[model samples]
Target chain A: MEMYWLLGLPLAGGITLAFWGHRAHAPEINAAFSLATLIAAGWLTAHIVAEGPVLIGGDGWFYIDAFNVFLVALTAFVAFTTALFSRPYMRIEQAHGRVNAARLRLYHASYQLFIGTMLLALTTNNMGILWVAMEAATLTTVLLVSLYRTPAALEAAWKYFILCGVGIALALFGTILLYFAAEQVLGAGGGALSWTHLNAVKTRLEPVVLQLAFVFLLVGYGTKVGLVPLHSWLPDAHGEGPTPISAVLSGLLLNVALYAVMRSKVLVDGALGGASLAGALMMGFGLLSVLVAALLIRRQTDVKRMFAYSSIEHMGLITFAFGMGGMVASFAALLHMTVHSLTKSAIFYAVGHATQKAGTQVMEDIRGLIKTNPTIGWGLILGTIAILGVPPFGVFASEFLIITTTMHQHPWATPVLLTALGVAFAAMFGRVQPMVFGETTLPRLPHQPALLPVFVHLALVLMLGLFIPGYLAHWYRQAACLLGG
Target chain B: MSLTYHLQVVNLLAALLLLIAFAMLSQRRIVGLITLFAWQGAALATSTAIVAWSTGQHHLYYSAALTLGLKVVLVPWYFFRLIRQLDVDREVEPMINIPTTMLIGIILVIFAFNLALPISQMAGTVTRSTLGIALASVLLAFLMMITRSKAIPQVIGFLAMENGLFFAATSATYGMPLVVELGVALDVLVAVFVLGIFFFHIRETFDSMDLKHMERLREK
Candidate 1:
């Protein structure tokens, strides 16, 4: 019941917001709805903590365990904060005539729908439902990505739609294959489609079929997760979409997709008799994505695109950590998900405000953010520091765990990982510092920037860096156990 | 019907589906490509119904009806309407020439057959031999998508590829659950509508329908 409300609130809010988006208070409505959903998520999380895991819906259509309850909470929390940030940022765009009321309605509507689909993807015990929800997310974000209706925006949206569309179609094929494999063992019907049942019977499944299914599923969901060679769509989608959309794209949607991959990875790993073929494949893709994104980040002229590449890099690191497949590595990967979501959303919020003030996303043209708006400049720098894994931030804590664990377990990967991380750090800071501290190139636009969400996120990351609360640590540890089992 | 005769008939329909897929790949005219797509869908539906009838799977009857309604009749109707409204039914020149594409399509078909051999042997379905044809059609549709310069033809290719996947599901594992099939059908419909709207936006943005125009958005 509580779980349904956690899913229902955002969906209901999204529909209502869409209907009332032309009203002057639409942003407020969006914020209130998001806050309501966040509260419900928190309530659900508390319940899970008190009661162990919660499985609702007949045959467990909705399952909330240690692994995903935290993610759901994180998704809602970030959505709420991004909503707060979007209020000011979007209003500024409206003032600049970059958006009209009709577009606002679309934005608010799709924003909620995006949240709903991600939540659906995260919660559903049915693999088919998960794929549907993922596809729904892609569709809604496609609308949002093309919101600006510029040639570039359309191009980005088109590429995103076609690439992900094909990728997910292949994923569907993989899903069907999995069903075929499971049907023979589980004896068909709904039990074969349920995650709990599939995981229970995973070791008994056929290896060849499961291997083929995993390959397709890997390429399919991996496209959504923005793995290298399949990640051409990520930067474009991020660069062209609204800043809030970009925030959610990095902070929430990508994680949901990776979560799907991780679930499938566990099954594939089990079926492969600990051969770790799936882990090696994931590590290969992860290392390549990190290296590719690191190099790509240096070439980016657009601030949003640069961060988009940074997202790919971080997602790669998380994938790599999970691929390492130990208790500590999975723990670190989960923590990385949390910290990356918080810190990256903060960075996007700051970047959104800064770009709005400077009237361009072009980094070199929009200089002296610190000089013109000290709040935004420092926020951007601080947020970037948090993302770049500096000390006293949660990212550094997780990255440190990942590095040390990799050195102990897979010594060969550590140098490559460190070099990629190093290259990414250099590329990011080298582009960002000049933008923050250089001479002001554009006149400051008049607006009350939303700095609250940015600061709030930064503060949370800072707290998490120094200390993770006991209950939270226990939650991650439990999830790690489940993942590594 | 005798089992061998029914299997042969299914194989014949599968061959027709593959031929249409190749025809779609080499097709230069938009309307002709769409017609090829509809024919491919018709062939797929016939084969699915035949498989369902011969095997008595029963659920695949619903699947056959869906393919006929959505693919053979409704989707092509939608595409025809879309092309009519756009008033841009021009030639769809390939990025690679037609002969090269056909040659590549033949190679892909051979490759798909080889790849499907092991999997098809694993599948116990009577229509297992058609699995190679299904895989070939899927690859050929993908090749069409890569070679076509026009957006609508690419979309048609995507739809055709879905047809192959549907056939693959039927041949390999007697089709997915009815609910998942319905969901996928609805999804494909909604995706087409979304892509339709995007077509207008893309054309409006660039004053043309060439995907080549979109290359400008790439990183330098």
Candidate 2:
């Protein structure tokens, strides 16, 4: 019942908020719902910790394990912080005439719905529900992405909708194929499409069908994960959408998509009898995304787009680590997910404030953030340093594990990973340094900016880097085991 | 009806469906393409109903009804209304010329048949032979989407591709569970309405429905 509340609170709140959020207190209402959702997530996490991995509502509707519980908690936390940040950020956007009152309502409402759909994707054990939730997320984010109603925003939203729509349609076909494969073994209806049941009977599934299904599933979800070759939509969507939406896209939605892929990967791994085919495909795509994003990040003019590519690069590294597939690697990958989400979202929040202060998103146009607003300036620099995998940040810890694991298990791929990370660091810091440390282009806004979310998230990442809490380590271990580590 | 006779009827309808897919690919006018798309859906509904009758799967009758209602009646009605509202009911030029498009469609059909051969043999259904046609229409629809430069035709191609997938589902595995079918139907409806809204936005922004204008958003 509590599990239902964890998913229900935001969903109902978001829908209701949409109708009334245009009033005087939209952001407060938004933040209140988000905080309530976060508390419920914390409560659910405490319960799961107390009692191991509960399945509620019977027969495959809601299943929570260590794997998803961490994600659920992380998603809620990031969403709440972003909602808090969006309050001031969106208000400033309105002041600048970039947004108006009606769009403000749309932003607040869509933001909550985005959180709702992502939570749905995380908690549901039914494969059909998972696909539906993912599609719903795309739709909600589409509204938010085009909320600005610029030509570029509309184009980005259209591209996101079409690409993800086609990709998800293909995934649905794959899910149907998975059902077809499971039907012969588990009978026709009911639990056949259930993940728990499919995972239980995975080994008995026909290899050819499962193989074909995984191919479609990988391409489909890989598009959402921002894997290269299928990732043309990612940078545009991120760059063109509202900054808060960009933060959510980078920080949360991508992780949920990867979580879905990993869910499917576990079954495919079992069906393949520990074969390396699935792993190799992931590794190939992961490497390609990392390399492409690294190279592309340097040439980007839009600050948001640059970080969007950085997101693709980080997701690539995480996907590569997960593809490596062992106790150390999967643990590192999961840790990387948590840290990357934190660090990247922090970076986006700082970037959002800095860009607004500078009155532009063009990298070359903005200058001397430190002289104008030292707090935001340093926040951007520090967040960039953390995301680029400097030490004393959680991303560094996770990247270190990934590198060491790859060195032991995949020596040849190690250099590629190293080179990509190095390039990404140079690209990010090189672009950001000018903005943070040069002569001013525009005067800083008079109002005090919201720097709390940035500092809060960065502090969390720093803490995780310095010390892995006992519970988090144990949680990662249990989740790694679930992934067949 | 005899089982073999019913299977033959499914095969004939499957052929008609593929032919209509090809016709849609080669179609030059927006209204004509919509009409062809409706005919393709009508063919798919007939084939599905025949298969359901032959196999004694009662739910597929409902499936057939849904497909007929959504694909044959409602969606095309929405499209016709949209084209009338948008005043874009004119020539639809392919990015690739018509002859080359037809040639490419033929090749896709052949490739789809080759791809479906091994898989179809594994399917134990009365409509197993139609699996190749289903796959072929899907690929052809994809090809149509690729070759069409106009927004509305590309959307039609997407819907047609969904038709192919639905037909594949029925032929390969007696269709997806009814709940999924309903969800997918609703999703298609919603997607179409959403895209219809986008048509106005695109037209307002660029004063045209050509997708080439969106290419300006690509990374420099």
Candidate 3:
């Protein structure tokens, strides 16, 4: 019963928003539903931490685990915040009349469905079901992306759909290969498709077949992770979609994709004597992505696109942490995941407000924010600092951990990571600080900023920076150990 | 003997599907592209039917029937309607020309064959070799997608890629489950309908179906 509400609250909000969204520009509805979800997520998070993983069954095929509980809570939290953020941002949109009730309905519904699909992807014990859930996520996001009905939005949606659809079809092929490999070990039938079942009998799985499946799964899901070469959809999706959608794309969607890649990473590591090849691949792509995104960030004029690239950079860094294959690095990866989610979401929320305040996403168009709206200006200033890995922020802690881990092993790569970080830092602070603090007289704005969600995430990020909870530190330590790096 | 007979027919059909995919890639005429896509779908339906017959899977026959009806008949009909309604231009200016596309198609075939080598060897089926051709066709269709300038041609390219995927499934594993096949068929239908709507949307925005115009929309 409780399991249903874990998925239902956002969905119900979506339905209600869709039905009466026109006459009723109800930020209250958005607030109410989202807050309810956050509370549910908080409850679930505490429950899971206290009680181990709470298993909700989709008949016998599905069950949640500890890993999924964290993701579900994260998704719900980020979503609820984005919704709270959306209340103000979308009303400005509503005022702009760029979107009508129908479009709002689409956005609301697709947002909930996307979050639900992501949670479903993370939780379900069945691997095939996981693939389908991810596919559902891809499809739902397509509609949300095209909601603005601009030509650019339409094209972005089409590109996103085609590329991701093709990529997911490849993932399905990979899943089929995994099933065959597992069937050879576990015998044919549903048993072949269950992750828990496969993990139990992982030793019997053939190394060569699993290796091949790993390639397919990586290339397939890596596209979603916005790994270089397969990352074209991401910038466009983030650039043209509504800002809340951008927040979700950066904050939640990318994490889900990385989580997918990590799942396969875990499976192959257990099967193939450990994740040497996968680790090497992850490192190669991760570093390359960091280098490329770091360079690319220097040239971006669109504020949204710049942050979109930052997302790629951070995800790259996180992937590199995972690739290093040490307990510390893995812990860093976990922390980076946490800090990055909080920080990036907060940054996007600020960027969205900045865009609204300035009447454009172009950086040059938006100036003197500090002179105009100090709340959002400070938000951007803090976010830019937090994202760039300034001291006493959670991002800094995680990034330092990642760097320290790199220093212990791959000393050669440390300079490159540092260089990339320096470049990214300069490029980001270069554009953003000016917009936040310098000059004067930007346009006056009527939009309300949701003070709570932004502050909540920032406070969390700050707290992590200031103090590490022993319980979470222990949990992550254990998880990293279990991950064997 | 029945198995061999079915195998040879499926193999021949798979080869034809690849050829059609290649032709669609190189073809300039919008009408011709749509025709080739229809032909590819017919081949897919035929091969699916052959697999069904040899395997004695009753559901596979339903898959073939659905493919035939949806891809070969209904989709082609819809394209014709789009052509008539849009009534714009005949010649499509591809991003790359015929010679280069065919060259790329050949290279993609080599890559596909290399990719399929191990997987095909593992499969204990007569149509296993066809997997390479199916993959090649899929790649070739993707190449078509990258090359084409017109919205209609890209859509055609997309449908042909789906044909390649379907053929790959049938060749590599006899076919996906009935539910999956039905889902894909429905997806195609919905996709085409959506694309039809998008075509009008694009036309209303730009006054042309040429994707080259869309290059202007790309971020500076």
Candidate 4:
């Protein structure tokens, strides 16, 4: 019943937006409704932590364990905040004549449906169904990405569709292979595709076959996770799409996709007699992506594109943490997932305002944001500091945990990571802070959002840096057990 | 060995698929590529039917039917319409020339067969040897995507690769469920619609469907 609300509420919101969201008041109402939903989601996630794993259907089809509940809560929280961010953003687009009532309605509808599919993908316990839901999420976003119908937006949507379509096809093939291996043990039926059943039957599944499937699955879904060598589609998608879509792309969608990969990692690690080789593979890719993104961030002049790289960087760090594969590292990875989603979306929200106010995404041209729009200027300032992993931000806590864990496991790997982090920190913040503070003040803008969501997200990051709630910490410990198991 | 007999036949069919896929890869004319794709799809449909008949999985006939209708008939029809509407009979040719693409296709075949050897050994199916050919066809299609400088040929590459996956599915497990086959067929249909729109958009944006020109449009 509770899980139904978790999936159905946003779906209902999506339907309402589709049918009747054209009125001027609809955006405000949608914003408020989503916020209430987020509060409920927060409560439900907290309950899951207190009660351990919650299985809502037969065969544990909708399991909310510690590993995922935090993600659900974080997803809802960012989604709510982004919705808040979108209310002002869309109105600004409206007033500027970029979007009409119809486009706004379409945007709201797709946003909710997008959130729904992502939630479905994360919560479902059937691997086959999980793959299908993830693919559905991809398809929905293709439409959303192309919602503007401009040529570049259309092309960006096409690239995203083709690359991700092929990726999902490979993932389906991988899922099939996994079922084949399960047929040998669990028999050739639906039981082979169920996550709970596979977890139970992992010992009996064939190692070679499982290894093959794992490779395909990782490469396939890892495309969506925006891992290097397979991340080409990401920047274009983020750069060309609307700001709200960019926020969702970085904050929720990518994290959900990584969650899929991590679940598969758990199964693969179990199959391969633990995370020995898998750890090496993930760490190698993670480090490569980190280096690539750090180098790429400085070269980018588009602010949205730059933040997109920051997203890639943070995702790389999380991947590295998980790849390190200890209980401590996995816990840190989950924590980082939560914090990164919040910080990145907040940055995007701030960037959205800056892009509108200065009327450009390029860094060299736009300046004097501190003089022009103080709320947005301060948001960028704090978002940069938080994103750079300053000591008093949530990102700092996660980064410190990951580095300390890496130090224990492979001490030599630490310096390389720190160097990459430092380079990225310098590259991102150096440009961001100056762009906000430097010369080029223009005429003041007429409209700005209520700064609550930005402040709330920044405060959460700050609080996470300072302290974690007791239950969340306990949940992370238990979730780490699941990761190790 | 009686066991390896079906393997040999599967290997032969796979080779045929790869050869045609490579031909499609090198083919400069849009009409020629579509014809190659049709042949590839026909091969896939036939192979799936053979596997299903031999395995006595009646549902596979449904899979074969869906493949035949969607890949062979419907998609090719759409491609022709798209080709006519787009008026792009002469392809711009890929970044790589014909000889180069053919050479890459050969390497892909060798790698695919090597990759398939162990998996085919484990499979109980008589046609398991075709896995290599299916993989080779897939790789060839990927090579086609890499070489082609036009938007439509890339779409064809995508369609042809789906053919390879279908063949592999048939050889490995008889076929996927009827529902899955239907879903993929619908997906291919929708994908066709989407690509058709993209073709017009690409032409409008850059005045040519040449993907190389659009590379300039990549965000710096």
Candidate 5:
């Protein structure tokens, strides 16, 4: 089945690369596996569109529906393109003596494993497996983040491990509590842990227990979503890890974690007979993250860290939109997820090359990207403009929908949202403009940078901004409905 | 009557687990903390086994064995080796003193019990009374993590938190499905291994396992 291949390819690639990842052609092999995964994801999306939502494996251990199918395709696509970017980027890292062969093997293998775990987290029907897969994803990336083994890198990785470890442990406690509630109705067994079964009997489940469980689950998974207050690990991990890892961390991993939170929100909403409580908590966290991250963006010296903060800001915006809890808000949230992933990863791709050419991650030290390499410079400028929600970009379209919906629904929060967006736009545009257009004495590197993935992602973002295709719009509507108003 | 007797034994073990969690909170030596962690694991495994026998949930028996194998024997052995190899068995001063940490732990225990009351009242398992203690142990371990500045003690605190979670699962819901239980067990084991690997890397980079050396990374 296409589902099996979609999950199997990255896993198989991880195992194989664990052995052969030190060779000269390992990056290509990594890219090949990612491409295969993307193809399988495409096939699975087509199958889902034709066949409707269905469960896979025995007793439906894997669930595929309109809600997650688009995300699956998006995760796979960005992963493949990030792999292509990493090929030259990592080689340059090696040439610069930052890493040796064995570390690259570790990097490649862990990258595949990380992708597989995230995909598993996305697709698993059982809530317990979702927790397991999410924890596994954290473990793999912890190693990748510390691959350079610098004091800063190790510190970032350790903070990521301990904080996420504690956060996820709380989530498991919540899962146990959920199972406790379900065992009273569904009775004990694996069936008690299945999301499908829990959703069916949600109204009959105990509301008090569900409320406690959702609190723990939100705080637990929200740590991974990089929500404010729990977001210290986000900027550090992104700043210290390899650029490719940063791309996926910002682009795919955060989205997957948010997906988990949203799924839990649905069950909690049904049990509570309204979305009011859950939506309020999410709105509080989301608005706070956007405001905090937007202000913090102005203070960043490292370009990657600055962009990392930008990621938190966008994720916050998406979370706030979802928390608004309407069909229009949910659709806009989905659109934001897609465009943010594409645009953020493209920005990282450009930043990765720019830093490599400048030989440092500090913003002030790097200059004249346009004079050094026009493609990467333009890519950085275009990607930054798009990400800052410039007109005729998908980000602007999604943000427009979100703001208008917020205006009609919750007028009081509009000024806060506008302030955060305005501050973020100014901070980001001011910082990036000088880097892209200013004069510099930087020389070109030996390896030609991979600009194709950057443009490919930006072009798609552009097309999405200008117009929404019929089928994609329909797909978003379906997903929005499933997420509930 | 027999069910009540088994429940009593589970309750006793749960109390012992909480007591040991408090002991871990007050302990200053890294070696003593690891020892306390092992004791906590032993108490958790025994309670899980007793619950399994009383409830007739066959899967929990396997979970108990796993706790015995990994938590009691393997992880402790590995930690002992790690401490010996790293030569970090010195006294670890808490950021907050022992008295302050213990006082905070007591408050957290009270808070946890209050939080768990409504949920525990709804749980149907015979061992449901221990849910509060289970949650308290988790909170106490978290407190220990926060108060300690050394890496090893913090890791032991994390492992102890997992033990508390396992205990909660067994008491409140008779343990998860065998597959999920196995997956959680494996993840914990891998987490320990990964953190252990980082232990050496951190030491190699900083020449000490103290977390204060890791203070360079912050927004400037």
Candidate 6:
């Protein structure tokens, strides 16, 4: 089945790379595995389009709907491109003596395993399995985040482990509460935890218990989504890890966490019978994250850390859009999720090469990117422009939809959202322009940088900005309907 | 009468579990904390087994065995070995003193009981009353994590929190499906191993297990 290949290849690749990832060709092998995963994801996407949503495996363990199927494809595509970018990036890290053979092996193995766990989390129908997958993803990435074994890296990993560990423990308690409510209706069995069955009988579930569960689930997964107050671990993790890991953490992992939150939102909304309690909570957190992260971006000296804050801000906008909960808002949230992941990862790719060329992570130390290498500089500038919601880009289109929807639905919040957007735009452009355009002091790298994936992602964003294909638009409408206000 | 007797025993164990959680909150020595964590795990396993026997939810028996094997025996053994190897078995000074931590733990327990009252009423399981104690222990563990500055005790705090969650699952829903329980158990075991590896790395890097040395990554 297409589902098997889609899930099994990364798992298989993880195992193979764990054993032989120290070889010189390991980066190529890693890319090959990711490409195969993308192909499998492509095949699975086609199958879903042809046959519609499906429940695969024994007892219908893997649920693939229009909601998650597109995310699965996007996850696979971004992961593959990240692997392409990392090939050269990791090689450069090795050339600099930043990582040796064993660490490289660890990075490659954990990379595949991380992708597998995210895919598993996205597909699993069981809430408990989803929790396990999310925890496993955390474990795999903690090691990768600390791959360099520097003091900062270890501290970041430790903070990531403890904070997320505690947060996820709360989520498990929430899951137990959900099961407690469900078993009263469905009886003691596996069906009590299956999302499909729960959704079918959601109306009959206890509203009080569902409300409590959603709070815990949101705070728990929201910690991973880099929502503020719970977001301290995120920027450090991004700032300290290898650039490729930062790319996926920003572009893919945060999206997966947001997807988990949205899934829980749907169930809670159904149980509450048109009450907007969950939506109100999401809106509060989302707006707070945007306002806080936009301001925090100005204080960042590390480029990756600054961009990580931007990710929090963008995720906030998407979460806010979803919280508004209507056809147009949900569609905009989905589009924002797509564009943000593409644009952010592309930006990280450019940042990665820029740091390598300048041999420092501090924004002030890196200068004259345009003079040193035009391709990397242009890539960084363009990606930043796209991400800042400049016109004729996918991010702009999505942000436009989100802002317009907010204005119509919740006029009181519109001015505040615009203020945050303006602050974030000024902060980002002010910091990035000097880094990209000003100086010629940096040296060129020995090897050719991989700018292809950067351009590839940017081109896709441009196309989506200009025109969204009919099938994709239809898909978004179906998914938005499934995620009803 | 037999059913009531079983319930009484479970309640007594739940009380003992709460006592150990409070003790862990006040314990200053890392060794004492790990020992208390193991005791908490023992109480949890005994209570889970009792629930399984009384309710005949056979899958809960496997969960009980897992708690015993992983929490009581294997993880504690690993912690003992790890502390011995890392030379970090010293007295840990909490950021807040002991009496204050205990006071906060008490308040948390009261809050947890209040929160659990309505939810426990809705739970049909015979052991549902223990849900309050379960939640209280989780909060106590979280409090312990926040107050401790050392790396190892904080990890113990995390493991204790997991024990509390397991207690909640068994008390509320008679344990999850066998498959889910197995997956959760495997994840906990792997987490312990991974954290153990990090202990050596952290010690090697910082030259001490105190987390204060890790304040290098903060914003200016």
Candidate 1 residue-wise lDDT at A151? 85
DockQ of 4: 0.29
lDDT tens string, model 2, A186-224?
876647777888989999988788888888888888899
Give me the runs in candidate 3 sitting further than 4 Å from their true place. Answer: A7-21, A25-47, A50-59, B57-96, B176-194, B216-220
Candidate 5 chain A weakest ten by summed lDDT:
A269-278
TM-score of each: 0.97, 0.97, 0.92, 0.92, 0.99, 0.99
Position B56, candidate 2: lDDT: 86
- Candidate lDDT (C-alpha), each: 0.89, 0.87, 0.80, 0.79, 0.92, 0.92
Writing each residue's lDDT as its tens digit, candidate 4 over B41-73 gives: 877777677666666778878887887888889
User: Residue B116 of candidate 1: its Cα lDDT?
Assistant: 85
Q: How well is each residue in A1-485 modelled by candidate 5, as lDDT tens digits? A: 99999999999999999999687799999999999999999999999999889999998999999989999999999999999999999999999999999999989999999999999999999999999999999999998999889999999998999899999999998898889888999999999988999989988888888888888999999999999989999999999999999999999999999999988888889889984788999999999999999999999989999999999999999999999988999999999999999999999999999999998999999898998899999999999999999989999999999999999999999999999999999998998999999989988978999989999999999999999999899999999998855
Q: Candidate 4: which stretches are off by over 4 Å?
A: A9-47, A54-61, A100-106, A147-155, B1-16, B89-96, B176-189, B217-220
Q: How many pairs of residues collide in each model?
A: 0, 0, 0, 0, 0, 1
Native-contact recovery for every candidate?
A: 0.54, 0.24, 0.05, 0.07, 0.83, 0.85
lDDT (0-100) at residue A241 of candidate 4?
83
**Residue-by-residue lDDT tens digits, candidate 1, A1-485:** 77888889878988898778688899999999899889989998999999987678877888889999999999999999999999989999999898999999989988988898899899988787788889889988898999999888988998898889889988988898888788888875666877888888889988898888888888999999999989999999998988999999999999999999988888888888877878888888998998899888889999999999999999999999898898999999999999999999999999998888877899888788888888899999999999999998999999999999999999998989898889889988988999899987576768889899999999999999999999999999999998875
For all candidates, state DockQ relative to the true structure.
0.66, 0.52, 0.29, 0.29, 0.85, 0.86
Mind giving the per-residue lDDT tens digits that candidate 5 earns over B16-72? 999999999888888888888888899999989988888898898899999999999
For model 6, what fraction of the real interface contacts is kept? 0.85
Off by over 4 Å in 5: B90-96
lDDT of 3 by residue, A1-485 (tens): 55667677767776777676555656667767777877887787787778774446654455655556666777888988888889888888878887887677777766776777787687667777777777778877877777777888877877887788777767766776676577667764555677878877877787777788888888888889898878888888898889899888889888888888877777788788874888888898899889889998998999998998999999999888888877899888888888888888898888888887777898988888888888888888898898899989889999999998899889998999999999999999999988988896766687667656777898899899878899888777866775654
Can you give the lDDT of residue A277 in candidate 1? 78
lDDT of 4 by residue, A1-485 (tens): 66888888888888988888687677776776677668768777867766767777765667778777877888888888888888888788788887778777878887887788788888887777777677777766776677666666767787888788778778877876777677667765455667777888786777887788878888888889888878888887887788889998999998998888888878878888774666777888788888888888888888888888888888888888888888889888888988888888888888888888887778887798888888888998899899899998989989999999899998988988898899898888888878888988478777966567777888888998999998778878887888854
